[model samples]
Target: MTQRVVVDPVTRIEGHLRIEAETSPGGEITGAWSSGTMVRGIELILQGRDPRDAWAFAQRICGVCTLVHGIASVRAVEDALDYQIPPNAQLIRNLMIGAQYVHDHVMHFYHLHALDWVDVVSALKADPKATSALAQSISSYAKSSPGYFSDVQKKLKTFVDQGQLGIFANGYWGSPLYKLPPEANLMAVAHYLEALTWQREVVQLHAIFGGKNPHPNFVVGGAPAPISLDADTLAATSVNVQGLEIVKNVIARMQAFVNEVYLPDTLAIASFYKDWFRRGEGVGNFMTFGDFPEDGTGDPSKWLIPAGVILNRDLTTIHPVDLNDPMQVQEFVAHSYYGYSTGKDTGLHPYDGQTNLDYTGPKPPFEQLDVAKDYSWLKSPRWKGNVVEVGPLARVLMLNAKGFEPAVELTQKALRQLDLPLEAVYSTMGRTAARTLESKIVADQMSTWYDALIANIRKGELAVFNDAKWDPSTWPSVARGVGFMEAPRGALAHWIVIRDGKIDNYQAVVPSTWNAGPRDEAGKPGPYEAALMDRHTLADPKQPLEIQRTIHSFDPCIACAVHVVDPQGEELTQIQVR
Candidate 1:
């Protein structure tokens, strides 16, 4: 008999996911499906709206990566209009995007993903003295925030004492995957607390460049920050060296945790849960749209992180990407609930695309080719009929394939420094570590750009946005453009069709759409679905947190791709804690 185990309303990550793992009588998972059950009709809401205003609306898709989406949407519109902003605009965009990365990554690590690995129950067993010592190793700021750890401990105690885990109540603390002693857990718990403090610092980076966090005001041609060349303006524009230093320092603290704590902790857990590396290791295919402008060229190949597509299973090398080439990219809304004209459910350009929302359960084998029976909010995205993984794993995989010396060297060094074999760097742990390390790489490279801008300014190279003449009438009668931005999660692609100075159609095949997609035309499972199949389910379903951590490590932004719903959908009273 097939039995179903479900975890509805998976929290922490954005969106509500109802995951059902179907297992045989022997307890082996035979099939698993993740459904995003909430629909906000963001696309439908954008209809009849000015193309320029789409970015502002798109930014509301997810609170975490709001600015990234906003910028990407604006970039798509700009590309559609063939409009280019000035150098100062480019620099400001870079600054905003970079700040988002730092803020998003830091928050994701501690607030969203940490609870999966951290055993809050173990923190109760920790000796406060030892925990304090671990904090000192992080940095002076960590040491100074003594009460933060205490508060976290108090909070955990209250929850555990109250017999309600609240957010963590259902977690599997005794699972074999949790190998850290109480002391280590205490240290992580302390860092988790301190991380909340740093979140404020990182968010200031966002407000400095973009105006706000959830949705920043970013103009298409340039930033929305009012330009000023006066002394006071220069002082405000002055790169907050200390603020950046605090971020670098905080990340360094995180790195210490990785090297001294997380890496070792992961291996220890994996040693007991060795079965995971094989399971949930979906299509070794990885793709990255490299980011960070080099010499102010929008050419992706010139970006600090070079963009490339790779078939990880075969390790095929990808050539340079061309947004103008239609044959190179296509979206199949076969499984999605969209209303549109349909042929083979596959086509090129804004005209041939269909948006029909007729999900008739899972694909019946005969109807699979017809694209009518598939059920999913996610569109089938294939890089030449091959499922490709996108995120840090993909980033590192492509970097390794290209033989990028610095990236390769850094990977090896980071792996070695963690006392793990080079091969370990290829696993889930490495993915987590790669994201942290990428920040270091980005920070160093961004500094070069910063210095260049400064030198140029001293040499009378002006870096200020001037007025731009934008005549919407000059736009094509019918124009289509693709905007490609490398989000913290992975390559983010947006296709926009504009006609008569208004948005005709727009579609975003976000990172999660690739990672968390459903079945496609040929009956091939999506990258994440396939990855989860091979996973050896631990003894208790409560420990599903392990599975959650592994998946969330990629920082899947499902909220931006599909819809979701609270399975319980029950309203509870909110009581303020004074």
Candidate 2:
């Protein structure tokens, strides 16, 4: 008999996500479905709006991803108008994006995903002295003290004793699958609390450059901030020498944490979960838009992370991605709660993308979604009609395939530490490890970008904004282009269509939409669905820790997956966890 288990409201992620899996009698998962319960209609809101102002509205797609949409939206307008920003602008954007990677990756590991691996209940049994020893053995982080671990344990005990585990509640703490000993769990928990404080300091980098952190202001031509050297000017707001020193310090702090904390913690945790390196390898194909421009944003060759597709785990031949080509990138809504203007079976490129809502699943508070019918709000995004995993793992694999020395060195070092083969990089734990490795690479490059910016400023180059195509009045009647970058989670692209100086149409296929989308018209599973099917087994169906371990590996951000609310405003579905 096949049994069904559902994890509704998959907590700790950005937005609402519900995962359903059908298991064999013995608890081996036979099939799975991934669904985003809400709709994000920010694209439709951009219709008829000025192309110059689109970045402000589009950046609101997700509070967590913050400036990525803003960056992409501005870049799309720049690409469409053939506008070139100054060199300083390019370097500033690089530093901002690089800081986001380091900050987002570390936050995701410690706050969002660490609970899946570290058993909090087990931490109570750990000796603080042992945990301090373990932390010191792994890394030379200055925070490794017996008293610090003891304080963390006391705080955790208070939560449990008060019947308020808070964020740590509802976790399967004593599961057999938790391979880490009590001391290791204690060390991870300590770092988890420390990351909360670390993230606040690093995000100041965004405020220093863009004027704010979340939903930072970005102009279509260049960065919004100006360069200044006036020591005492109250009216003029700009990035002066003092501000530059602050940014440098922030970068140094970010690099220190990635090296001394995030990387070591990931390796230490991974050493105990070696089997995960064999499981959760979904859709062997991978894709990346390639971010961090070394020179100008227009040149693909100058991207620090190269954009390409790797099919069937092939590292030798890299397929080029032309976002404008309809045949190369397309989204199908066959298994989604949407209807295309043309037809349900037809796949549409983002340039002609439509978001016609058609809810066909069971009403809210229901048990399981009808897998045979339209199930998810996310449209299945396919690259050449194939599912490709994206994010740090994809970027790392692409870099390794292209023989990039930094990526290769970091990846090989990690593999050697775990005593695993190269093929192991395709699994669940591999995804987590890849994120840590990527942070190191990006953190190292941040220094180069900072140095370049200072050198340009010292040479008396104060040009930050370009007014070449700032005004839409001097533009083409019709223009369309794709703005893409490798986001923290995966490949993210925004396609824009402008007509008569207004946004005629806009479509943003975010990173989570690519990884957590439903099956395509041909019934091919998306990355999340494919990874869970026939690979995971539940020791306790009521407590689905196995499902979380695999899903968190992808770091699903459902808030970015489905966009907007219906005008009718009626609650369409209510989630029922069973």
Candidate 3:
């Protein structure tokens, strides 16, 4: 008997995901459909606006994504106008981006994804002293004392006493799938609260550089922060001696947590879930747009994370990625709620992408989405007609493939600890593991980037913005370019067309759009759908912890799941995620 299970609006946090899985009589997921219930209209709003101001609006696409869209938007305009920023601007951008990567990944693991594997309610029975021993056994983090763990446990007890587990509710707390002991659960929950405090400190990097966070300030040709070392102007600028020292301190804090806390906890937790390494390997193909440029040359080879595609899980041949190549990178709306001028089944390059709304899904108060027709708002993105999974796994595989020594050694070291071969990295647990490994890699390297910025400052290369193309008359009549980066989630790129000094067409294919999109023209599932069908079986149909595990591994976020309001200002869909 085939049973259809609908998990609509997943995640207690802001998510617009709707997963419908068809399970066999044995509770094995045979097929799955991933849907983004709300429309994405940010690109449409950018039409006819000043090209430079697009970043301001584009950055608002997602609140949790931080500054990724802002970075992509500026890069798009710069690429379109052939505007090259100074080396200092590039370095500043890298530092800001690197900080976000470490901070975002840490938060995702502890706050968003941790509950999927951890049994929160089980922590109440834990011995705080034993929890301290578990914490010390893994890493030398300073807060590993019986008293510290006891306090954290008390906080949990208070939440439970109030008739709710607070932020930790709605999880399969005592599920048979949660293999961690009481001590491990308590230790993880303690660190979860610590991460919330850790975030406040790291965000200072963005405030010092971009002026603010959660939609920071960004300029098209260069960064907004100016370099000035004079003591009188020191208080006004971010590149002075005082600001640099603060940045150095922030980097130290990031390194300490990733090394002592985050990485250790991941390894400790993985010890109990080794079997998960065999499943959730979705669409063996992967891609990266590449980011963190070291120079003004803007070459992919010089990038810290090299860009390429790995097909069929083969690391031998890494195919190159070209965003502007129409035949290579295209978006398909066949299973989506949008229409293309070429055809519904046709694939169009992002520069020629269309956002015409043609929603044909079920009406309001619907129990289940009709998987047969346009069921999602996200367009299926493909590289060379092959479905590629993007994010940490793709970038890690790229690193290992490109023989980046740190990534190669890290992967080998981790697999050796888990007592598994390299092939295990091709699964769901592997994806989660890859995110942790990369966090350390990026965190440690932040110091190097910081040092280079200091060197540039001492040598007096103080310019952060390029004024070469500031005048509109200097630009050509028409231009189009693609700005791309490997966001914390995965490959993120924004395509822009500038005509007559204004925005002509704009399209942004974000990370979630690639991973959570519906099927393509040939009827192929996206990464989430494919992974759900890969060795996934529901232990109890009522509590689908298995589904949450794989989905959260990708850190799924439907930034486009905006509101659906009628003409009279009433919400069309009253979808409450929690």
Candidate 4:
């Protein structure tokens, strides 16, 4: 007999996600399903709206990755009008996006994903002196003293003693799956607190350039910050000499944390769980839109992360990705709570994408989703009819396959340190390790971009905004374009169709949608479902910690996946997850 285990509203992630697994009598998972229970009708809302104002609305897709959608939205409009921004503007965008990668990755590791590996209850048993020694052994992060870890332990003890765990509530605290020792767990807890303080300082870079952190202001042509060297104006008023100095300091601080803390912690923790490198290798194909353009946006060769697809884990050949090619990329709604104009089985390219809600699953508060019928709100997106995993791992693999020296060197060094083969990168821990490595790569690149920006400023080239196509009246009567970038989670692309200067149709195929979506018309399991099946086993199905470890590895941002609430407003299943 197969037992069905359900974990609803998967916590620590951005939005609601439910994971249902079928386990055999021996506890090995035989199959699984991934569902985004809610619907995000942002595309429907975007229709008939002014194309220039789309960024403001689109940026609200997810509060966690606000600026990513904003950047892609404006880029879509720019692509439609053939708008070209200044070199300095490109550098600034690169710096901002790079900062997001560093900030987002660090936070995800410490706050969101660390608990899966580090046992909090065990941390209370840890000797602060031993933790301090362990911290120092890894890297020279200044807050490695015994006193610092002691304080963190005391705070955690207070939470556990008070019968109120707060964010740490209902966790499988002493689960057998936790591999890190008491000292290592204590060390991680201390850094978790430190990162809380560190993130506030790092976000200053975003505020300095974009006028705010979350939902930062992004213009259609270029950045909103105006460059000036005038000493008379206040530092807050403009991007002056003082402002530039602060930006440099922020970049330095970001680099310091990635090197001294994030990278070391990831490797140290990963060294304890080598088995993870063999499991959770779902849908071996990988894809990346390729971010951080070194030159103008039009050329793919100049991109730091190249846009390409590697099928069946074949590093020998990288398939090209053409956004305009309708036959190449398409989305199917067969297993989703959506319908198509042509038919439910039909796959439509993003350019002609449709959002028609047709919920035919079990009502709310149900035990399991009707996997045989429509289940999730996320449409199954396919790259030439194959499921492809994206995000940091994909980017790193692409860089290595393309013979990018820095990425290749870093990947080899990591693989050697872990005593694992290159193929190990296809698993869950590989995703986490790849995130840390990419942070180092991106943080180092920020310094180069910062220097370029300073050089442009020193040469008296203060131009940031381009107003050539600011007015929608200058656009063609009918225009369509695709704006794509590699978000912190994975590949993200926005497709827009404009008619008479208004958005006729808009579709955002986000990273989470690609990774966490349901099955397609062909009955092929998506990335999340495929990973959970065959290899996963539940030591305790009630606590489902094993399920969370794999799901959180992808950093599922369901807020970016499903947005709109059903007007009928039926209360579905309510399950508590720590």
* Clashing residue pairs for model 4: 39-563, 39-564, 40-563, 40-564, 365-572, 365-573
Query: How many backbone clashes does every candidate have?
Result: 16, 11, 0, 6
- Evaluated at residue 251, the lDDT of candidate 1 is 42
- Lowest-lDDT window of 10 residues in candidate 3? 569-578
Estimate the lDDT of model 3.
0.88
Q: Per-residue lDDT tens digits of candidate 4, residues 1-578?
A: 99999999899999899999999998889999999988988898789988888898899899999699988998898888888988888898998899999999999999999989988789999999999999999899898898988888999899889987778777788888898999999888888888999999988888888888887888888888788888565655567777788889999999998899888999999999998888897899999988888756567788889989999999989999887798889999999999999999999999999999888888789999889988899999999999989889999999999999999999999899989999899998999999999999999999999998998888999898899888877889999888888899999999999999899999999999889989999999999999887378889888888899899999889999997574776653332212
Where is the poorest 10-residue window by lDDT in model 1?
A: 363-372
Q: State the local distance difference test value for candidate 4.
A: 0.89
Off by over 4 Å in 2: 233-236, 564-567, 570-578
Q: What are the per-residue Cα lDDT tens digits for candidate 3 across 208-247?
A: 7888877778888898888778645552355566777788
Q: What is the C-alpha lDDT profile of model 2 across 1-578, one tens digit per residue?
A: 99999999898899989999999999999899999998777787789988888888888788899889888999898888988999899999999999989999998999889988999899999999999999999899999999999999999899899999888887887889899999999999888988999999998888878888887778888888898887453212678777888899999999999999999999999999998888898789999988888766567777889999999999999999899999989999999999988899999999999978788888899988889999899999999999989999999999999899999999999899899999998989999999999999999999999999999888999899999887778999999988888889989999999999999999999999889999998999999999998278898999998899889999888888875575587664432212
Model 2 earns a TM-score of 0.97
The CA root-mean-square deviation of candidate 3, after full C-alpha superposition on the true structure, stands at: 3.3
Q: How accurate locally, in lDDT, is each candidate?
A: 0.63, 0.89, 0.88, 0.89
Residue-wise C-alpha lDDT for candidate 1, range 129-242, written one tens digit per residue: 666665555434434244656676788798799997767776677666676667667767666666677666556555555656667677666666644334444323443334
TM-score of 1: 0.84
User: Per-residue lDDT for 495 in model 1?
Assistant: 71
**TM-scores of all predicted structures:** 0.84, 0.97, 0.97, 0.97
